[model samples]
Target: MNLKIQKISILLFLFSGLSVFSQIKEEQLILDKKREPEVKKIEKKKTSVESIKNYPPEEKSQNPVEYSITNVPALSDFQTSTLQADDISPNLKTDYYSNYVRFGMGNYGKILGDANVSYTLENKLEVGADAHINANHGLQNIYAWDSRQTSLKAGAFLNGYGEKGKYNVTADFGQENYNYYGIYALNPASDVDINQKVNAFRVKGSYDHFSNEYLNNITFKSSFLSDRFGAKENKGALDFNFSKHDLELPLNDVKMNADLGLGLETQSTDFEILNTNSSSYFLGNLSPKVTFIKDKSYLTIGSGFTYLSTNESNLSLDRKANKTYWFPKAELQLAKSDELKFYAGVDGGLSLNSYASMLEKNLYIVSDQRVTPTETKYNVYLGIRGDVDELIKYDVSIGHSKVNDILFYQTNNLFDTSIAAIRNAYDFANTFSAIYDNGTKNEVNASLQYFPRENFNVSGSFHYINYKMENFDNIYNVPTFSAELGAEYTLLNKKLLLGFKGFMASTMVTNLYDVTNTGLSTNYTTTEQLNTKFGGYVDFNLSAEYKIHKNFSIFAIGNNLIGGNYSTLQGYQVLGAQILGGLKVSF
Candidate 1:
């Protein structure tokens, strides 16, 4: 039989139906992630089985079986990756000097000057100093009283690039002087001069770890403020943060992290809320957060527990200012691509307020203004941001807020028969008062930036807000709608730059009190209230700069070209048009 079938090859065709299964265990991926942040991702592909196709039966098979079948096996999942960036280098400009000095002068006896100096030692340490001054003489013919102001600011800083962290320390000082001249029908010849002179000092320090984020940073700040009106303040704050990354959860396979922050603040002031009472405050907060990141999304949840203790001389109008607050800090981010993102969050906290801080906002406020902390119960917001072709970027957001004890600048209600009869500097509607109110606020915000070319760019921002207060009819000095637009064009090899800026705001609300003399001159009283509205104004500005040398440039700025008499507060008018020319020297 072997000799006969040697040449003829008999192929045995056996047909059978069978099914096979295999259990495949997925391999968990471990990524060594460092905090060079920001992410966008998508999920991986799943394993799949290919369906078997039908085949024609063998017509001349001698050993036929029951049936014919095919088997399909799944393919194992795999991923592909590109080269990773593991090294970095310094990208410093060789022909650039960051230190400069500028000086300018304009009409109305205006003067402006600023100087900055910096030095780097051995590529490890840096020291810098800066100073700024702006002053203007009195504008007498335009206003009934003198309108004059002088401001000076100076600062110095030290920085060190340590092996494991970075260190920064800074000290700053400021001096400001201005007159309360926002009065109506006042005689300039009368020697009724009330001045507001303030002096401030601050010291700040920070330390940030480079690689070890567990002890991420520590920051501390202290400030001292005093004024010629016999008010003084001393305040300090300290905070630190720690973080743990790539935490392995109990039973979940996701990227996670934990972060914790602790802060402390204390303030004691002789700033009189009334004429005789002082204020003191202390606050401490502990915050903790956990973050979980999956394929193309991230979620963070946290809370801030704050203990606040305050004593405003226990005024008769209020019992005490002591409370504990809990604020939610939660957010989620979903990314469709590297350039597009959607985010939503709910967060709130406590805002510490002081007389010196109030002066920073409204320089014409009363010296004995009432100051207290603000409590934000919650802020819920949603936003979307994206970039197109690396040339344009846009973001829009909408939010709602619940707030307590918010501050507003309103005109003081005081009466005087003559300038000499004014008892306080803020009398005669010359200065503002620190008014507090509770309310719910809803707002919308949008911004856009376009960088179509290296030499030309444009930017715009818009905001809309509405407040429903509980006790007050209106929120003083707050605009409901605002918008700002700016554009810059650089030609002549980036040496000749032209800039344009414009800002617009909607109507603002304020109130005036009607006064009626009583039976005697001693008891001055009135209860009737009056609501006033000031129409909004629009303003536009332009600037141009030309470089004569690499280290020198001359610039001119034209402000309020629209000349619409823009005023933020009542009875105060800005200059119609102004032009200031300045020179800069870099070395």
Candidate 2:
């Protein structure tokens, strides 16, 4: 296939997808309004009355008619609410938080802030904040994916609040600090370090109104997020309904309903490597979704068409022309009783002659390297659960996914020749995930959970992956595993408590019939062998609330009892057992 022909084909498909995006409905401008009278009344009631007081005899006798029922609309059949929360035993809860400050031999140090704090303000709004700072002196895997390299992520996430129908607003901001020794696949043996940071923010507002039918109530939501990883995402949506349950339609012996929504989104990403810089994206999208619901049984179908394009900015390759991409999505669900549920979904999309990495030329890649600019995908899933009523519960699930013309990154030392190759070796040498000329890559995953009580629980999940790489033998199957357990118990008349939790994982690559490109890949696939790595820690915390008198108490806490060494990633070390004890006084 000629390079010119490939470029033209990809351009045509991208343009066609963009045309669909142009038809998306424009967003309606919103005008902020002053708090309404009812909002003011609610605010006043909170501070004016100590509690609900009985109507005085004099006022009750004179305003008897004011309290009549004619002012309020009769409740309808569609009015309902369903609130389900993840259930964890005492052991699981303890382990979940304790895992943050793990303990073990050969561990770097520790990271801080596994717990959180939130505050409530006027107008039904709440503010939340959480922060973590990890600074280890040497190579640690405190937060690294493989626990091999050393790095740090100093960040915080803030949240503000308001509801769809509530007359309120909420927002938050966050930032992360990164200082690492090497980009995962690069000279892991080298001491050269890199520093980076990321910042993000989100805000929302909603208004409420009384309604008689399902279509009268309206709610609008919008949010924007930006990440330093060279990605910026923004999306806004509007949801209007009379009853939240209008989507629940009546079908046979079950209750049923459906909801329809339209939305638009845009995203941009920039990859920064030694010698290459490129941007690939689905800039704008028009999406629509509809859901059908019945008692413990339901199905949902959704689809979106996006105007996608890729921009390659590298000194070595001719700038790839911009092209459009189209992606369609769908999902289905089935559930029988509280203990059993199953679901499946699929998303199909495409990419044009996109850049392979920060350094490489877009014009000189093989059929696999330069996607036809046309692509498709498929996905499926199944799940089951048991014993919802007992203290003990169990769950299992599986999922499979496949994609065509999927983009990938690679690095090659032997292939370097020109200055560009040496400078951008990690970028250009990296191979993209394999794509069959016929178009596709596949993956399978499964997981299980067990809980015997609210205080303790355990779970394990794993995945098996296989891919066909471009220009090389089919890649080997890779298997990954994760397991965790923990518990929490209270003493001192439920005033004092202790909690602990831990987890471990293992990764293996099998059937690697070909090793030619092993070194060209990220993370340097060395040792065509079995690698065994595992770590766990038990965190013991003591918290107490002592009542000095009525309506008041003093609270104190001690953290990280065992000084565990745990690394979330390969080289980032967590902290050693250091304690921060503090007291809070209430009146």
Candidate 3:
């Protein structure tokens, strides 16, 4: 009985402990449920603050430190730095044409034609061909005088460039026909027909090494000329030039340049006459020069050594000569600014003379004539040139020159008078011969230009010369004073162009021969000299052009508008007022 009672008490105690543990767990679960919503609310508030800090501002301020609308670039409007096609201005660009043609006819039976075409390759090589024609039947007032002329020329050229230099080659052929009509106007009683024809062929080539340190340039040329009078001439020349620029000099702020050149020329002429005379000439020249340049000034010191040899079969003469000439060049800018500048220089050179060239200058020259080259010993000049303002500019210069073997035109009186036809023709033909003289000349020249507007420009020049001949009493056929004035105007957006030109010259002296019977015989005659003076006159011309399209245009030109009859040569009277119209096309 005592053991049962003890077991019951132990059971009661165990039950009480289990009930207390259950109460504690239930209270803890209720507290956890109530705090869950508070933790979620704190997480939502933290997310809101982070979003506000990440967003950008809406505007930027003028002050760099502050944000405002002015400082921010608009995202909707964007531009690139490169130029767009739409931004190019058409008026500042010019269109190029690879082919061109021009044709014209005028009063006095004048006709003209010209054409040119060119092609360029991918390698920068270019090739081109061109042709031209000009002919005139006769003047209206001159009746049978028939001042007719025709000239035709055709040429082709090839040009290319390389990494170091450029090169070009050209070939050409030409023909010219002219008639001597001045005799009829000078002597009405004489009747004669004089026709002259010239044919020429030429080839030329040049290579320039602009970047080469040693070899600079080279040139070669060959030409052949023939006339109807059984005269032929062939000429060839070769030239080379070497230069060094920016050479080291002893002085500071000063640069030096040196150049060396060599040239050789050969010419041969044949005249088909009774004697079959032939002449040959060989010439060589070596030139060396050094130049020094500083601020606003330069000085060039040079010397030319020449060797000349000539052989004439008919005269049985073989002549050889050598000469050396020293020429110094200098220029100084008297003013510090470009608006006003004064400069001076001394220069001289040798001039070549040939039958073909002489014939072109004076067609009346005898077919078989003697000729010699001219030498310009020295020329000294001083000049001032500058712009007075944006609208005006002026240049004036004074110079003195000493020359040897200067050519002059004079009439010949050495023809036979036994035959009536020969005498009459020779006496009245008024043909000219070339003569040489040594002399000194003084000259003054002045030029002025005005550009008052963008589309208009006017220019005028005046020249005065004084000649002192050592062997002759006076210099023949040379004008002492001359002047020219020209003006150009553009209108209608450059579609129409107008031009005016005027020229004036002073009087000149010419010689005339008077025939007299010396009572010796009918075949014999005496000639008396009569020095005549020709008064100079002024000439005016006008020209206009209108463009109908970019590729086509029409032009009209009027010559000698003032109608002042004048003679530029001894017995040649110039044409009166004449008009010409033409069309120009390009593609």
What is the per-residue lDDT of model 1 for residues 1-587, given as tens digits with 9 covering 90 to 100? 65344213111100000011011111111111111121112211121111111122231122333322222211101110000001110011114665677787876566767676767677657787877776666556677556777767788988776655667898989887777766643334435676778899989999876543488779999999988777889999999898876677674567887899999999877754345447789999999999998756789999999999987763453435778999999999998674788999999999888977787567777777666889899999999887776677788899999999978877776645433364555565567778888999999999887876765667778999998899887788888887776666655555666666566677788765654555566545644344577646555555666777888888776655544554566666555555667787777
Question: Which pairs of residues clash in candidate 3, taking residues 3 or more apart in a chain or in different chains?
Answer: 60-67, 60-68, 61-67, 61-68
lDDT of each: 0.65, 0.34, 0.62
Give lDDT tens digits, candidate 3, residues 222-338.
Answer: 999988778899999999998877677889878887889899999998877434567777888888888887765667777777777767765454555555545444444465554
lDDT, ranked from best to worst: 1, 3, 2
Candidate 2, residue 51: the lDDT equals 12
Candidate with better TM-score, 1 vs 3: 1
lDDT tens readout by residue for model 2, 1-587: 45576456445533543353333211111111111111110111111222111222232121222221111111100100000001111111121111122111122332222223344455434443332333223334332322221212222222222222224354544443334322333332333324333344545554443222344334444444333334333434454443334433445654433333333333333443333343344334454555566666666666655565455454465454554544556666677765556666666654333322211221112112222344565555555544454433455555554555444322222234332232321232322222233323555444444444432333444444555545434322122443433334433333333333333333322221112334445432332222223232333333333433333334333333344444322222344433332232221
Global CA lDDT computed for model 3 = 0.62
lDDT comparison, 1 vs 2, better candidate: 1
What's the residue-level lDDT of 131 in candidate 1? Answer: 76
Model 3 segments more than 4 A misplaced: 1-94, 184-191, 248-250, 273-278, 313-335, 387-394, 421-428, 515-521, 524-530
lDDT of 3 at 161: 60
